[model samples]
Target chain A: MDPKVVNDWRLRGQRYRLEGELCDHCGEAIFPPRDICPKCHEPAKTPQTLSGRGEVYTFSTIYSAPEGFEAYTPYTVALVKLEEGPIVTAQLTDVPPAEVQIGMPVEMVTRRLRTHGEEGTIVYGYKFRPASFWHASTQA
Target chain B: MSSQHLMQPERAVGIIGYGSYIPMYRLSSTEVARVWSGGGRGPIKEKAVAGLDEDTVTIAMEAARNAVARAEIQADALRAIWVGSESPPYAVKPASTLVAEALGATPYLLAADFEFACKAGSEALQAALGLVGSRMGDYAMAIGADTAQGRPGDDLEYTASSGGSAFVVGPADLAVATLLGSLSYATDTPDFWRRAYQHYPRHGGRFTGEPAYFHHTQSAASRLMEELGMDPDDFEFAIFHQPNVKFPSRAARRLGFTAEQIDTGLLSNLIGNTYAGASLTGLSAVLDVAKPGDRILLVSFGSGAGSDAFVWEVTERITSRQDKAPRVTDYIRRRTEIDYALYVRYRGKLKT
Candidate 1:
């Protein structure tokens, strides 16, 4: 049992499906659920799945990536405001960095984040893509 | 052998929803030829390529999400989630579990991966139909996806593409296309194989044509149609596993099908050979525009020398559910062409 595997396993709910907690007291959405409400400072444990739809609040294009991510240099990382009222920071994929806009609509998709060399676990999590206007309208 | 391996579930089953996912990147055959052959074009026009962060599991997840959306069923209701791929990221770990967990079909779901070359997707579909038809589950999802691989300069490089399709099989009454019957024909003729630990596959070249793909494909299709007493004239569309642009056309003609019948579903020229996703993606394309009462014949060929032939009749429900998710043509229309350098880098052809 690798510690990295265990750590990733523990956060599978949030990474894979955007599982967040809803404040039962104040109705505020909390991402990376800490079991305690930030708004009312009360115990909040109601699990809620997000719609995975969002608009980019801001983004940065990275010319120099970290060690494992060197192959994907010049990738875009964005602060996406999820439709459910939580702002999550994640990588933007399937769209060119030059094309990414601050207010562009995006939708979550599962993607390979990285692998541990050749024999280690391949970490998969949610990434956002430019959502088609037709698709977004239909979803709305 | 007298029964011809014809299989039908005790209860009727149908496809409640269907969806496909083609990656955003495209690499033209010209690029491969320019780098390797120094000139001339390859077989097909272009092929889809997975992004740096996309693979079999990610493709399966997206396609399954679309299927769930079109079915309008809770992901937890799926009793089985099966993925068929030739290029799974892990050789040992199961890609199906990741897909199931992401879809929220965890804990109680039957999750597994299947491999049978190109027809792997149809194999999963057959098993899903059986699961739903036997009353073992109310709903089951079968996905065929691949980020297929090819040697750097091999002929396969031109056509081994990336994409996949998924189907949600459930009760016949709730279906968009009802499964009438199916038959499978297989033999030990090895037309293509990738030994354990090998990064790429090898094919029998000319041998893949007559004895393997053609033999199994025609056998299963003819036998299923014979057993069901149906002919080419009865089907409105025909889909065949496409390793290239020519094989399916030749198979359809020899099997008494017309060019018009197979034209709507012939997608290999655009997306190249998606292997496990080949025929399933073609079926998704056909399902996009098929009308009520239209009968369809699908035959899938796997290199292990097997073919799964099925007869499906579209139901009235197809009209209402067709727009619930993005269509196959929509994915095809959305494309970004990349050079050979980026393709090799994204596909990991170059050792970093």
Candidate 2:
């Protein structure tokens, strides 16, 4: 069995659906969910699913990618502020780096993050795309 | 074997909602020809290309979410989720499981992956109808998605593309389009196939026509119409599995359907062949503009060789749900063109 599989499995909720902890006492949203809340030091045991709709708080374009991501050089990564009040750092897709703007509305989409190797598991996670991409004209 | 009559579910079943997903990037056939053949156009104008981070799994998930949104039903209410794809991301893993998980329809859901070349999506659609009609499940989702590949410089490269559609089948009363009947025709013709451990598929060229696509598509459509006591004139729209622009048009004309009948549903000329997604995406496009009481005829052909023919009638629910999610034509219009180098990189045609 691959060790990476266990780690990926543990993070499926956050990776697959943007599931995070909602603080019951403080009524605040927490992402990459820690069991305890940072705001009030309360137990944030309740699970909440984010709307996956957000605006780009900030971004950077990586012309030189790190190991394992050389194929995706010139990709843009962004800090997205979710509608539910949580900030997430994720890769942006479908739009060119030059087109990326701060405060741009984006939506979450499931996409391949990386693969371990030729025979290893292919890891999939959430990425953001321009919301306008989904609102094309009905007339073809 | 040919059925004496069209198959009906134990109870009335229909599509509660439907949705389609086409990737944002496109690769022009002209670019493909420029690289290899020294500049001449290929069959279609351009083809949708999935990004490096996109695959059958992601495409299926997006389509499923749109379907659930249009159905106006809770994802947990869906009892079954089936995905049909020729180019699933993993050879060993099931794409359906991941889709089910992403939709929050896990544990209690009956999920599985299916393959039958291009007809695979309709295969799942038939099973969904049966599941809902039998009263075993109130709602079931059938998805046909693919990130199809062709060997570098092969004729198939010009047309192979990525896209998919999903349908939620439920009781007729809640349906946007009701399924009237269905029929299937199959044979061991081996017109196209990929052997084990092979990355790309091979075809029998001209043999894929006449004996495989035409024979099975015509046989199934003719037989279904015959058994249902209907004619091409009875349908407002028609959809056929589109490998390219020519085949489906020729098949439609030969089957007595007027060009106008298939005009709205003919999308291959714009987006290329999406394999298992071919016919289902066409259906989604027709449903986008179909009026209530309109009838639709759909026939899908797979290369291993088989065809699934279905008859559908739109209902008032279609009008309200058509705008709940992005329409098929919307995806068609949202495009970003890339040169051959970027296309090859995105599709992983060139190994690292």
DockQ of each: 0.58, 0.69
Model 2, span A1-140: residue lDDT tens: 67789999889889998989899999999997999998999899899989899999999999988877777878999999999899999999988899999999999999989988788898989999998754645432
Model 1: residues >4 Å from true position, as ranges? A133-140
Index of the highest-DockQ prediction = 2
- The TM-scores that each candidate's chain B achieves against the reference are 0.98, 0.98
Candidate 2 colliding pairs: none
Candidate 2: Cα lDDT at B62:
93
Task: List model 1 lDDT by residue over B285-327, tens digit each.
Answer: 9998999999999999999889999999999999998888898
**lDDT tens string, model 2, B81-127?**
99999999889989998998888888798999988999999999999
- Candidate 1 chain B least-lDDT 10 residues: B1-10
Among all windows of 10 consecutive residues in model 2 chain B, the one with the lowest summed lDDT is B1-10
